[model samples]
Target: MAARRITQETFDAVVQENVDEFGLDPAEALAEAVEQFESQGVDLTNIVKAVQSGASEDAKDNQTHTVLQILESLRGHVGTANVDGMPADLKRFTEQCKLGFAQRYLAAQKDAYPTILACCRKVDGEKASLLAALDALSSLTDGQPDLLDAGGREFLMGILREHPDDPAVTVLAVRAVRHCCVKHEQNRQDLVKAGVLPLLTATVSRYSAQPELLCEACAALRVMTFDDDIRVPFGQAHDHAKMIVLENSGLKVLIEAAKAHPDNTSVLSELCGTLSRLAVRNEFCQDIVDLGGLTFMMSLLADSLDHQDLVKQVLSALRAMAGNDDVKDAIVSAGGAELIVMAMNRHIGNAHVCEHGCASLSVLALRKPNNCRVIADSGGLLVALQAMKAHPKALNVQKQACMVLRNLVSRTQELCPVILELGAEPLIRQALASHQDCGDLAQAALRDLGCEVELRELWTGKKGSLTQ
Candidate 1:
């Protein structure tokens, strides 16, 4: 009997059968089929060339399904063993095919921006296809900002505007914005300029029932509002972006998102982070408090004690919100001081938590004598002191801890001796000598501790004048 000859159709049938019948991954199934053919001494050179050539056409089509097919085909070949030792022509063909597919797909997306924008403007039956196309474009523009130009960003905003009620479409659109802004400040600025923040906040509010959408929307807001450049300098609010976020009711949306998805840690973490960024300004600090931000954050910390990421973000938000006297008092009224100290004890080795925790307490201690008393009474001072000693090399922790000590001692004379009793002087002096940035603050703290003469002498290396 003559054996049946293997052909391209035979391999395709085997792959399709494996995929359709056994539900195997196409790449794995293709790999298995290739191995079977090789076992039968069937050369795969012609098959590789055929697959590579097909990928070129698939890429040119520039449709989601075609691109996905090309990706799967490439994965299949790369997953198959011994492909590296194949003929140099096959190897080169595979490499060139992959490169060409990527270039062609990206080129198609770049050229299709206007078409995508028109699709985004459609509010009819093309929603699904539009969403699929947006998803594909998102993948194409993941790390390629050139593909996500101003027109592309406007199209994304259009999706959010036209389909505010469509969770799936909104999620894709927001995720595309997130991908655009992840590592690109210009994209972030552009998104902000395009008023994506309001759209994102609306997405969070409209899709409160969808945890996935809330997470993506919040994630985008987190990235868009991440501006270390515009900071609050010298007790003045300088972050206009944050002001815009406030104007659009961004905080209300985030709080609502948190309430809607209390169990979603990712959503909660992003919400807390975005709120922290917004609260950097004093004007927004009171707004966060008015919105019950302090109580919400304390509850999150209390409930999410096991989630270090969530707890750290909550602490950061608390630090930012605590800048206000009303918020500080509100935090104390809600047992926030104890919460801060408890987080410090819980995540001792977590430098971020400790640093933010101390920073929050320090903020609360500033100009609020009752807050200072509340912190010292809640054992917050001891916690900050221990945090300083434990993470001595952590400059941020030390700096924040010194600020807490300074605030507690400067305004609350009753707590000054308590800080010294906790042996905070050595830590302050060590921080003074170790970290240059923390020196002035640490010296001020030491002076408030009644070590002015000693600090001045140690700082200047001269004890000529004790009275200046």
Candidate 2:
């Protein structure tokens, strides 16, 4: 049988029934009625005009709900429909409703925050409602974190604590925490006070097989660890914030998540990012090596040439881990050195890749003369020179490149003439003049070239200033 045509009277009756019998809010009842009418192939223009006119007292009392109803209707009309072919009037109405709802929602957040928190607190057995509320809160709080006050933070934490076994609720709750804590120091401190780190670790460990939950948990941990305010003074705790994560067994859980989902680039990226941050400390550097992090990072670099971001992160972690001679040699044994040089030459214009690549080479060169010889034979020096000339403004690249040259020339004298012949003097001088941090290292490299007389003249612009 053909669907019955829904007239204005039929629509109004459904709305009245919903409001009188079910106690549905007037706007919500109207939205439901509109959904039913659309299902029956009724013309929506009449309902749209009626809602927009604001003629009814109920509509006037709940303007936000009315706007939300229209927004939902507009969304339904456009759902799975080719937007490029949408009617002009319908498209215009949809855009207008969306903008209006956004303005109203932002304006109402000051009053809505506490109400949302209260709703969250009362969601005991209503998992669907709880998920809906959390999703809305996540959208509402994006780039508007101040709306999540201390109480709001507490409510989110409570959800995580109360629904520890529910993957859906845990994922949503962790997502909310991630959004709220990113770039917000006070919120991060609040989460720390709530002992969210251990909770995150436990969630990650418990839900390793659940990729969605693992992704969210890893994202939350990534943001929490990246906050600068959480970092302790250098010698006081030496990567104190990362130390907290390590203490909570965060690395172990992250590695397991990565291993569990080897095909998941997102999980791997976040996992690599967290490891890169933690590897800044020497103690965690060894921990990463022990956890097979070096091999994992090398595999990411070798296998996933398409993922530049992941490769960059992997290089960063390697740069940090290479601070240790043993790990440095391990990177070489794992073919990590060749991969670094390949990434540098491939992404020559990328300042970050060049900087970390050179930094890693510099670390590998230190105290290991044979590694310096290997880098030079692999055309690593040429790549460093190209990086220096390509990105003259990148101070770290210039510094690390100069350090690599300095170490390579100091250990292997035959390479000195080759470096000077490659127009090394001018690049070194340019680096010396432009970057104060690079001057000492660049100057030392110039000295290692056995050009003390030329260096004195370059420094004084006159002859006979050398001290024999």
Candidate 3:
């Protein structure tokens, strides 16, 4: 066949012809197949057939070579075709190809990564094969880390090193490095030392646009930082690892994902869960507030009333966000205090919601003198006081209410008087007296209100009754 036109069929036929007539080198045949697959879009099924046909006649010694050639061809197709169409029976074929070629390439090259790196680089800018290639690479790495040597390793890193901003590569590298770190502590440090934190952080900060990527990158970062060898490094990199998950991007994606898929309770719950962790960090708490995370988080709480667990998660996120003064103020400014009180009053029958809501209100009350008044003025102090008696059977609810009283009494002595005036002392003392099991929390509350001249006498009166 004269020069076959540069399409898929012609490319495959041309490669086959060369392999048949000239006994073309296996590598060259594979390279030709890759070009054809790229141009003609040959399915994996077809490649399997072609490889089998060629291998059927190979001598025992050359069977491995033929199989390796087939793998090389598939590897080159990494991100091109949706391998989903490939038959399951072909899995053996694919795996054999990966092991045979990758092992030989690694051995002969002795750390040479140019070829593999070139393949990965091809994946870099090609949208069609980016995910496909990454998926293949991930599978190839399942249990074999020795598949590439130092040169190959460095080359792969270089592909990432240069285009650190590309989301696809950045995401893939983050995943690969994390995988390597799981087995090798040194890999975690190497990635950190290689500046993966900034890359991960940047990806979070800018790529919130891609939720899957955002989730994956965050997950990888969480893993890396959890490892002792790299936790300190990751922490030192970003002001003590304080803002690990509370960045603009993460919050944005979570909020957007919740809004985009309201019916997906599991996904929304997961988002709220991530926010809860980030919200607890002082460094990130303010960032969450600054980004108006409070309002979106509160809305999630309201929208999830039917989902008790999700409501609790959203409430926990709210509590974490409001743990500090600035964040408390943000919540108050965003009308979160009012919204929280509404949720609390409406969901009092919900034990989980009641527990977290009361506990969170207590956290906000103790923030500082200035913020305590805002909390009390929002009817928070009274609602919590009532909730104590209404849900007295709820051990956690009672404990949280006591804690809120402790905070309020300590922060705003003036408010301490109002707490006492509203029969607060009676409710708190009742819980304190009746529940010896909660003595620690009760005593803390009693201690805070001790100096309140009016409330001191009340605790004293209840002290005798506490034993009864």
Q: Which numbered prediction scores highest in TM-score against the true structure?
A: 2
Clashing pairs in 2: none
Q: Which candidate is the best by lDDT?
A: 2
lDDT of each: 0.70, 0.72, 0.60
Once model 3 is optimally superposed onto the true structure by TM-score, how far is the C-alpha of residue 329 displaced, in angstroms? 2.4
lDDT of 2 by residue, 186-249 (tens): 6777777778888888999899888788878877877776644433332222343574555787
TM-score of each: 0.67, 0.68, 0.48
Report residue 218 deviation for candidate 1 (angstroms). Answer: 1.3
lDDT of 3 by residue, 1-468 (tens): 333224333444656666888787656776767665656544433233233234455552344333445455545444465444223313433354355433333223332223334445555555444544444454444334444445444644665567666777667666665555554445555556655655666655566556666666656555554434432333332322443553235555455555555565565665676667655467568767666566667666666667777777777877877766777766666666666677777777777777887877777767577657877888888788778867877788889888887887786777767777788767777786778676677777767777332223334554466535
- RMSD (Å) of each candidate, 1 decimal: 13.7, 14.6, 16.9
